[model samples]
Target: MGRSRGGYSTKIHVSVDGLGNPLELRITGGEKSDITQGEELIEGWQRKDTKVIGDKGYDADKLIEKIGEAQAVIPPKRNRKTQRHYDKHLYKERHLIECFFHKLKQYRHLFSRFDKLARNFLSFLYLVSALFWLK
Candidate 1:
């Protein structure tokens, strides 16, 4: 958990399949940047033909290079000097991740951050994700 004006907080980072089912999940300090966990989320991913879609926060030179053969469909930040083009149609699929989060938040406990321990929270996350897979 991380301390901020509101209180202790944590960030849940998830990677989902093309179908919007979660593939991996990680917890980080609320203050941590999204890019910090980018590499680890896709570390052992072996799919070379897939497109890696993400929001602007995941846009970075190292991450783009790390994507290797997989096409990085992340949009560049507004402040970037060079505006790189990405497949707009593919980028639209990013809403799947947003939808997944909306569903995850519907669970009151997870939404309210009742679990103080990260491990407990993550365990519940795994359980919930498994439930999603079962559906």
Candidate 2:
């Protein structure tokens, strides 16, 4: 959890498959940048034909290189000196991940952060993810 103006908050980082099923999930303090956790979320994802779609926050030289053979559909940030092009059609698929979040938030306890311990929260997250797979 991270202390902020509103109070303590946690950030949930998730990686979803092409079908919008979650592949991995990580929880970090609200203050942590998406880039800091991007690498871990993509760790061991080396399928050459796979496309890694992400928002501009995941745009970084190191992370891109880590993606290696996999196609990266991340749009370059506006401030970058050389803007890189990405597949707009594929990037549209990113909404699937957003939809997953919407579904997750429908669970009141998860949305309200009822669990004080991060471990407990993470455990519940895993359970919810499993339930999603079951459905």
Candidate 3:
């Protein structure tokens, strides 16, 4: 968990397939950089056709290189001097992960983080995710 003016918070990173089904999920402190978690999220990804699409927050050279065979569609950071090529068409699909977060917020406790322990919070997250998967 991370502390900011809003108090303790967390960031949930997730990946989805072309169909918008989640392939991976990671929970990190709200203060943690999204680019830092980017590589870990694809650690064991085996699908060659997989392409990771993320917003500017996830823009990092290490992540782009780490993705290896799988494509990365992260937009360059505003501070970058030279822009990198990204698939605009595919990057638009990154909204699927946003929609997932919107659905996750429906669970009141999750939205507020009433659970003190990260493990417990993660358990509920998985449970809620399972519900989404069932749908």
Ranking by TM-score: 2, 1, 3
Q: Write one digit per residue (lDDT tens) for candidate 3, span 35-118.
A: 878877888763578887888988888888888888888889889988999988888887888888888889999998998788
lDDT of each: 0.90, 0.91, 0.82
Looking at candidate 1, the ten consecutive residues that score lowest on lDDT are 42-51
Q: lDDT tens string, model 1, 1-135?
A: 677898979998999998899999999989999999999888766368878888998999999889888888999999999899999999999998999999999899898999988889999999999999999
- Candidate 1 has a TM-score of 0.95
- Listed in order, each prediction's TM-score against the native is 0.95, 0.95, 0.90
Give the clash count for each candidate: 0, 0, 0
Q: After superposition, how far is residue 94 of candidate 1 from its true place, in Å?
A: 0.6
Candidate 2 residue pairs in clash (backbone atoms < 3 Å): none
Off by over 4 Å in 3: none
Candidate 2 least-lDDT 10 residues: 1-10
Judged by whole-model lDDT over C-alpha atoms, candidate 1 comes out at: 0.90
lDDT of 2: 0.91
